[model samples]
Every structure is written in C-alpha cells, then in structure tokens.
Target: MSTAAAHPAVRTRSLGDRRRRTLAWVGVSLLVVLGVFVAGGVAGDAASTTALADRNLGPSAGHPFGTDPLGRDLLARVLAGLRLSLVVGTTAALVSAVIALVLASAAAVFGGVVDRVVSWLVDLFLALPHLVLLILLAFVFGGGTQAAVLAVALTHWPTLTRVLRGRAREIVTSDHVTVSRQLGHGRGWIARHHLAGHLTGHFLVGAVLLFPHAILHEAALSFLGLGVDPGEPSIGVLLAESMRYLSAGAWWLAVLPGLCLLVVVKLVDTIGENTRALLDPRSAHL
Candidate 1:
C-alpha cells in the first residue's frame, strides 16, 4: 500500500524502522571513526618523540594536526588520548552498571528494610553533586587511572540502580514470578532465571548511556590534574598542557584535541540514545 493510504500504525512503524536504520548507520560511522583513532594510536610512535626544531608548526602534510610546543605530533597524541579515554570510559561504565545490577536486584528480591535502605542510598547519592563527589573520591584515591575509574564507577551507579530497582519491583509482582515463588523457587533462582535475564537490555542501554558521562568526567578530572598522570597521553592532559601554548597563537594544539573529544562524546551519546530507543517497546511505533 502507498504510505499515505496505509493505516496510521503502519505508517508509524515504517517511520520508526527508517529512523532505526539511520541511527544504525550513524552508530557504525561513529565506530569507524573510533577504530581509525585506535589504529592511528597503535601505528603512530611520533607522539612520544620531541622534535624541538619542528615545534609549534601549523597543520600540513607532514604534521596533519600540527605539532605542539613540545614538538610532539598532535594527531598521534589525539589518537592515543582518544583511545585511553574510550577505554577508561567503557571500563567505568561497565563497572557502574554491574554494581547497579547487583544492588538493585538485592533490593528487589529482598524487600522491606533492604529495599528502603537501597532506595534511601539512591536518593542520597542522587542529591549530591556528581562532579564534586567524583573529585573528592578521586583525590582520596590519589588521582590516577584507578582513582578516575573508581570515582566514575561509584558516582554513576545510583541513577541506574533506581531504574533497575523499579523494573525489578514490577517483575516481582508479575504472575510468572508469583507462580515461581509458589513452586518453591528461591530468590536466587528467580533472579538468575527471570530478573537478570529480563533486565539485561536495560543494563546494556544504561551502561552505554553512562559512557559519555564517564568520559567527560574523566577528562575534567585530568584537566584539573586529578585524573591521569601528567606523563600519560590523555585528551584531558593534552588540553591542560595546551593552555600555555594557546597564548602563543598555536590554536591547533588545543582545538584539534578538543574537537576530537567532542566528536567522541557526541557519537557515544547518539549511539546510546539510538540503542535505548531500539530496546524500548514504545518506540516500535514511533
């Protein structure tokens, strides 16, 4: 049938399908960009070497992203930094999601006092400023990769835990869950077979959505000298070091790295939104 002549539901489904396809293509393009950065980081060794003679050069065939004041290739440094940021962000998000799953599941399966305590903790964390809390945690851990990861992981969990807890509560009241309970199925059995299995998609989407936040926070921490070591090639560190050279009119030093970070964050966010929509049943007719 012609699109205009089709039923409203059919048209809606078609539109949603097209949107999902477009989003899938965009996600693939983003992945390709990320892969290129990873490959460049692996292939480029010029980031570590300082060529004083070539310092502060603008973009060219020889130095596409130009050279920093320290004479390190900006392109290479950006790629390396991008890779590190992605690694740290993904690791932290995954850790956060896992913690959320465990705590949320426990609260749902073992209700009453446990649920109240978990819910209270979630509310408390949600009320606190994430960045400030993250910085404090990072500082306590002495400000390195471990500190950044831990801070991001710990700080990001409360929101996702609340979501999972709500879903778990709904599942607990389902007829199959009631039947399973009557059949002598323990909480552990229902959790493993029903709750965990059903909640996997939510967990995955939550983790993906958390990635950009983790990356930005990691970069912010590093920029403030509370994240990665100064010697490490991270996007935040590169931007932090670039401040001194910007006054000398070497704009590429800061601009390029900043753009790269922005692109990565935007792509991750887009992918997360797309994934969430795809997983959501309501979006089927959008």
Candidate 2:
C-alpha cells in the first residue's frame, strides 16, 4: 500500500529507459553552449567594447553584431553577458531548487502540522504575481546580482515545492516504497534511496525549466534598472542602454542582444521539454 517503500530506482529507470537517443543529443548541445560561455567569459572584456564612431555599425570583420550607441562591441558584450547569465541563472535556480526540495519534502513526508504550514506558505507565494513579487523582492534585497538571484529564488521555489510535494505523496503510496519501509529502512535511507529515485528527475527537470525563467527574471529586473549593476554587461542592462540610441539611429544595440537573450531562453526551454519527455515516456508517444 505504501509506495514510499518501493524501489524508486527501478521505477525511475523504467521511466528513463523509454526516452529516445534524441534527448541525449539535446542535452549535449546545452552543455556545449555552456562550455563556450564559460571559456569566452575568461577571454572577453566587458569594458573594452568599442566607441561612438564605431557604435551602431553593422556586421563587419572588425566588428561583428555591430555596435551600440555607446560604441560598445555588441558581440563582446553578448559574450560577456552570456557568462553572467549562466552564472546568475544557475546559482539562482539551484538555490531555489534546494529550498523547494527541502520544504516540500518536509511537508509531504510529515504531512500533519508542518504540511499545513508549508502548504500555506507555498500558496501565499503563488497567490502573488511573479514579477510583482520579484520587483518587491529586488527592492527589499537591494539591487545587484544578489538581489536578482534572491528574487528569482524566492519566486521560483514555491512551484517546485508543490511539485515535489505531489511526487512525495504519490511515492508514499507506491508498492516499492511500502516494501522499502517494511524492510527496516530508516526514514533517511528511504528518502535517499527510494524517494530520491522518484524525485530527482522531477527536481532536475524543474531546475532545467527554471533556468530560462531565471535568466528572464534577471534580465527583466536589469531592463527595469533593478537588476545587475550598469557597469556589467547583462542583456537587460545592454537593452536598457540601447533604448536611448534607438531613437537616434542604432537598432542593433537593442535588437541583437534581445535576440540573443531570446534564443538562449528558447534553447533552454527546448531542453526542458526534451527532458520532460524523457522523464515521462507517455509524452514521447504523444
């Protein structure tokens, strides 16, 4: 009767085995881009982006992706921004994911007094709109990369908590989980070996989905001047700077960088979807 006693690893394997090879390739592409960003950041310069005369120029050998009104090298800024996005996005999502997992696991596994409290907190957060909460959070946390990360973490954790709670509840009733408990497994052991089997994929999938949202949330705050500081080359900051020049002559400053941000989010989303498909084999059929 207790799924919590189940052999979660076996179930997880069954779930994963149904996925096709395409999912692996998609994952690899994401890793490759991540590597390029890390390598490029070490070699790139945020401040060295070109000047006024060179600003707003179209693609050329000397300057690819053209220049912004401030004459900053759009390509270079993009590369540098990529690094910032990757770091900020990953850290924010991971921090939130951990919090969500902890809170949700506690609620689901315990399920009496603690469950009500955590469920209420999760509901309270969900009741508020994400952007409104993020901005308010950004202000309270104070503006910077930390604020952006904290704001995103605060906003993101609730959904993951709910999902984890749901999975925990289901796993609790599963046959393998019940058997595991009867076999004299400790709570920690059950949670780690069994519950973890059913939940890790969910958490990982949620984390991947969280990545694009993290990037977008950071960019949104930066766009509104509440995100990463101006000196840094964030996509949002770049777009904000480009706004003034767009009226004068340059369009690429905002457009190209925006496109780059857009593409990154899109790619992340695709990866998330593929991961979801891999985890949920019925989706592969659909």
Candidate 3:
C-alpha cells in the first residue's frame, strides 16, 4: 500500500466507511419493522375473518402461510400478531426503561437510605420467579392486552436498573459532578443537568435491548390465554390454537408463524446490539 493509504488517519477513514454500512443496515432493519407494522395494520380485520370451507390448507400462492382451522388467513393473522407484539413490547420496554432510569438515578444521587431502598427493591425483583411473576401479574390485572403489557413492563426493569445504577454512581462521583456540587448546585440540579444528560444514551440502549424480552413474555402470556383477547390473532394465540391441529398433521399451522415470530425477535435484537456497538466508544471502530 502507498504511504498515504497506510497512514493512521487513512485507516480510520476506512473504519468510518464500515460504520456507515452498519448504520445503513440498522436503517434497513427499521424499515422492515415499519413495513410489518403497516402490513399488519392493513390486515387487521381480515386476520379475524374466517372461512371454514377453506380451513386447514397448507401454504400456497393464495394464502402464503395457509389458513387456520377457522380458515382465517395465516399470513394476515401473523402480520397482525407481529404488529400487536411490536406495540405491546415497545410500550412496555419504554415504561420499564423509565422506571429503571429513575430508580437508578435516585439510588446514585441520594445514596445512603435512598440507595439502600432501591438496591433492596432491585434484589427482591431479581430474585423472584420471573415467569410465575408474569403470570400472577397478568392474572391479577384480568388477563388482556393491558395486563400483559403491565406484567412485562413491571418485571423487566430490575436488571437494567442495576446496570444503570452502577453507571450513574460513577457519573455522580466524577470530577464534573463534584465541580457542579462545589458550585452550589443542589442534588436535583446536578442530577437533572449532569447525570440525566450523560445517561440518556445508555437508557435508550437498555430499552431497545429489553424489547425482545418484552415481546416474548407478552407472547407467552397470550399463549397461556392471559394475553391479548383470543379474538386477536397474536402469535401466542395462534400457537395455542395450533396445538390441537398439530395432532391432525397440520404442521404449517404452527411452524410458519413461530418462525416469523423468531425472525422478528432476532431482527429487533440485531438492531439493539448494533446500536449499542455504535454508541460504545470502545466498539465504535468495529
């Protein structure tokens, strides 16, 4: 290679090209998510419409994912399920993230008694039986979309809280924070200006990573008949309904929808991981 091309700045410029490509991939993934949401929304009513005469069909040109025993189009139903999962997961993840951020910030900023209380709460939540807790919460809330969202939201925050708390504590003890305090800023002022601002990226990345877990939990509750109403063709509901027919040798009823769910989850996970990588100074070069 030429001396100019071998220069450190030139190598860094090539790395920038890789970073741009990573960004492009993220954009494409987001577009795919948007397309699924839109398609599902468009198929909302059709997802519930049934034609018994056309029931139990396998994949074909007309119905790409085939038809359920109720003869509702599986493709449409899966799309609708995905759309619903996206909504529930996104809402739950955001709520959970906020809860984590607040508790972590409080624990870090106010230390002593406040820190102890937050630590106790985080430990208590972390020690519980996660799936059982989800079921209990969903059951308590009367088992529907709202219940499922609440159950997932409430259960997923502890781990993230612990992570953010450590980061927040580091920030709190930093020279900049010390300087702000010496300038006569109150705890609230320092937290609002210094702590909150620095932690925004971490908060966002945590929320995105939490999304797949939220989606899966929502589906699990739905599969157990405590999620979205049975009238809604959620992936869980579809899988639940497919159980009986699998014995009758209707394999597509479960396989295709399940695969679709897996794919969507994996795609969201990829987005989160890449976003984190790009945001982390240590990983930005990769």
Which is the leading candidate under lDDT? 3
What TM-score would every model get versus the actual structure?
Answer: 0.92, 0.86, 0.95
TM-score of 2: 0.86
Give the winner by TM-score: 2 or 3: 3
By lDDT, the better pick of 2 and 3 is 3
lDDT of 3 at 280: 88
Candidate 3, superposed: residue stretches over 4 Å from native: 1-7, 283-286
Question: Which candidate, 1 or 2, has the higher TM-score?
Answer: 1
Per-residue lDDT tens digits for candidate 3, residues 5-123, read: 78988879977987898798788888898899999999999898989999999999999999999889999999999999999999999999999999999999999999999999999
Comparison by lDDT, 1 against 2, better one:
1
Cα RMSDs of all predictions? 2.4, 6.9, 1.8
Please give the ranking of all candidate structures by TM-score, highest first, separated by commas. Answer: 3, 1, 2
For model 2, how does the per-residue alpha-carbon lDDT over 60-89 read when each residue is reduced to its tens digit? 787778876667777888878877887899
- If both were scored by lDDT, which would come out higher, candidate 1 or candidate 3? 3
Assess each prediction's global lDDT (C-alpha) against the native: 0.89, 0.82, 0.93
